[model samples]
Target: MDIKIIIDDKNIKTLTYDSPVLLSRVIRDSGCGFSFPCSGKGVCGKCRVRVTGCVSEADEREKKLTGENSAFRLACLTKATGDCELFLPDKNITALTDGLCSRYSHSPFGEGVGAAVDIGTTTVALYLYELENEKLLSVHSFANPQGIYGADVISRIEASLGEEKEKLRALISKGLEEGIAELCDKANINKEECKTAVVTGNAAMLSILLGEDVTGLSASPFTLADYFGKTVNINGMRTYIPRAISPFVGSDITCALISGSDIMKNEKLSLLVDIGTNGEMAIKKGDEIICCSCAAGPAFEGTGIRMGAPAREGAINRVWQERGKIKYSVIGDKAADGICGSALIDSLALFLSLKMTDETGLIKNPTVFEGQPAIEIADSGVYITQKDIRSAQLAKAAIRAGIDSLLNSCGAASEDLGRLILAGGFGSFISPENAEIIGLIPPGTAKRTVAVGNAAGMGASAILLSRQALEKSEITAKNAASLELATSDFFMKSYIDNMYFTKKD
Candidate 1:
């Protein structure tokens, strides 16, 4: 039977299935984009789809989850019995392709054109450069098509261990190829002109793309199959992927460090935090750099929240309290549909200040939003529920705890840091003061905090344009030290302690 998946009434994808299967599995297998906040656990109820054809009737659990919207079924729980048409929400993700790039002399490997790619778990960015003059031609980005399997790396890794491995590889491979074509089209150049590329990403992404065995990444010890500091063929293009620092901390951080070299020169002890699904951080103490990664989850990226979203159109990105009234700014100047990470942090700060939420992250005076106890925005339908607060709390605690662990390992404190460079898309929009207020970052470090948006992409571009940058990336990857946080008692203790919002002195 054929299942037609319609996205926002315009984009459509049809998949053929033989037996009745879970709608979530069907969607996952179809490679269609859908937000599985809880990885299709059916607990979040965020994967709501309208089915018009043969489908299983909603059970008690599904009925309870769907509430009064009986017409809609949770994709995770519902089963597709026969040919059906599924109406899905539009996933117009806003990817961060631009970053703070430092200029370097042109010393590229070859002539013509080249592409530099940052393959983030959620988004992938490609930068095209003219190798002859080292001039940037165009930039392009898109949601990682592998997201249909799951939201986090763990989910993707599990999926890659099975028959769906090739599907996963092909999706990213095709996405990058299309992005390269798009860049060439916009730049008025032939595809043949782009002969070389540098692709940087986490270990799992790199491993999957290269079609390497990833069983080592599935369990403890988390052995990395390949360090990947060499050149290989990627869909017929000669691609160079940078080396990773650790199993969790991949080449993305290596590229970020390379891009931010100018910013870390003066600081004796500088810290870089790449806030994403994995809270990857690096502490450069003297000439040595030590790195670590914590499982921060996807809460910061708006996953697992009742009314959370990425920094996209209709998403709230900033929030502030003015004269006892909560004020917010939305992306695209549109009506608020959901609150993103930066706003979520700001809201927590504001909530704490107004005594709306206590130190334990409990809503003091919660109102009803979507039939659940939530803090609703006045006039706007967007709201944040208790679960959302917990999700944010876990993510923040993990990040902060990881920072503390890294600082402690170097016999240093937050005050000892001369610079705190925040990297990644979410890091760029966050208010340092608000982050401190919510205990997402250390106190009194806001003055030193600097957000360098998408440093990894910038570094990848540097590698594409300059050989020195590429050489530096290779050296940094070889020298950087990786720390295991799971065994650290300090990390475990600090994680629990950081869960409680610190009282502002």
Candidate 2:
């Protein structure tokens, strides 16, 4: 039956067969940006859409999953049986980042075209920018295909240890190929026309993408095959990878160091923290910069957590007290779906402020509030379990520990730092107040903390667009002194001690 679904006052007509297709897929095909974390597994519950007119009974699974009134349905699980109107809530519509699509339009230096890539554990984002006017031409992003094997890099590393190594390589390669093709198509240019691509990712991701054995990276004597800058050809696309400082710390940090050049050059001591699955940190003391990395896991990126997701449409990204009431903003203003990285941080911070969560990373009282939906339940307890707190604790601990270790390595204290540069996707979404309350960053660092949105990607783009920038990146990578946090006794102790929401001054 053909049906007309009215979303946000716009009538969308489509033809359907017998059974219902996933409302998420339907909306996505209809040019609606609906985000589905967990890849529409009905686990995220972020694809909620309201149905008008007569509708079928809610399935037991969805009923138990959402707990919303009968009218609301998980778009991933729902099917269309008759003509009906669907309403996409404001919270479900993801707002596009300003200037992201225009950052790479014209080349500053003639005869130069470059691409910046942020090779994340769960998502890969690319920006095509022209060097001339620093105009962004197009932006492309997609779920990291490597996620099919497992959600985290550690899982992928373990899987690579088995016969699935080839599969891992193919997975990363396919995603890069697809992303490159999309960028080229959108920019109306040939692959060859793209003069260079600047790539940034963790050591494990880089190893996997290059088809290098990463067994050493997983265990002791952690050593990378190569850390120095290298240029490789992938399907005729010239790609430059910054010289990795260590096994766990790869070009991503090096790129950040380059993009945060101003901070690094400041005479005053500073700290740069790029929080992610692999937390990378850098501390500048006078003319020297010391760097370190810790395994923070993928808790913040929406893995490990039952209903967590990346910052996408329908994912809750911010939460605050609006006139003494809890209010939140979703990535896409469609509907209340799943919690993204930012939302998880906000939730933890809110819980802390409300005394619902203790300093020991314990949720004192776990209950779904009225009007809010419950997304997951397991033997580990209900939504936002103690286990989730522990997971987030580990993540925060690794990041904080890295910061502490870097400061100690530089023979300086947090107070000595004049500025803090927060880089990467985690940096962009993390609220200063929330970060400070959870102790992810030091107390006074937030005031000096400047969120450099996607510094790795921006740095990569800069390198691609200018030969001077590429040389600077190479120099930055070379100067970086890599500190292996796993081998440090202080780091281990700090990681354990900082695994709480308490202050560690």
Model 1 over residues 1-505: C-alpha lDDT tens digits?
9988887786477888899988888777666756676678777666788888999888877877667657789999999999998888777785787787776677886678999999999888888998888788998888888877778999999989999899889989988888899999989999878899999999999999999999999999789888999999997888999989889999999999999544447457999999999999999988889999999999989888877788789999988877867888899968897888889999888888888999889999899765667898655788888878988999999999999999999999889989899998999999999999899999999998988888999998888888888898889999999889989899999998898888233
Predicted structure 1: lDDT: 0.87
Best by TM-score: 1
Candidate 1 segments whose C-alpha is farther than 4 A from its true place: 8-13, 261-263, 369-372, 503-505
* Global lDDT scores for all candidate models: 0.87, 0.70
Q: Model 2: which ten-residue window has the lowest total lDDT?
A: 93-102
lDDT of 2 at 187: 92
- Show how many residue pairs clash in every candidate, following the order shown: 0, 35
- Cα lDDT of candidate 2 equals 0.70
Alpha carbon lDDT of residue 484, candidate 1? 94
lDDT of 2 at 140: 83
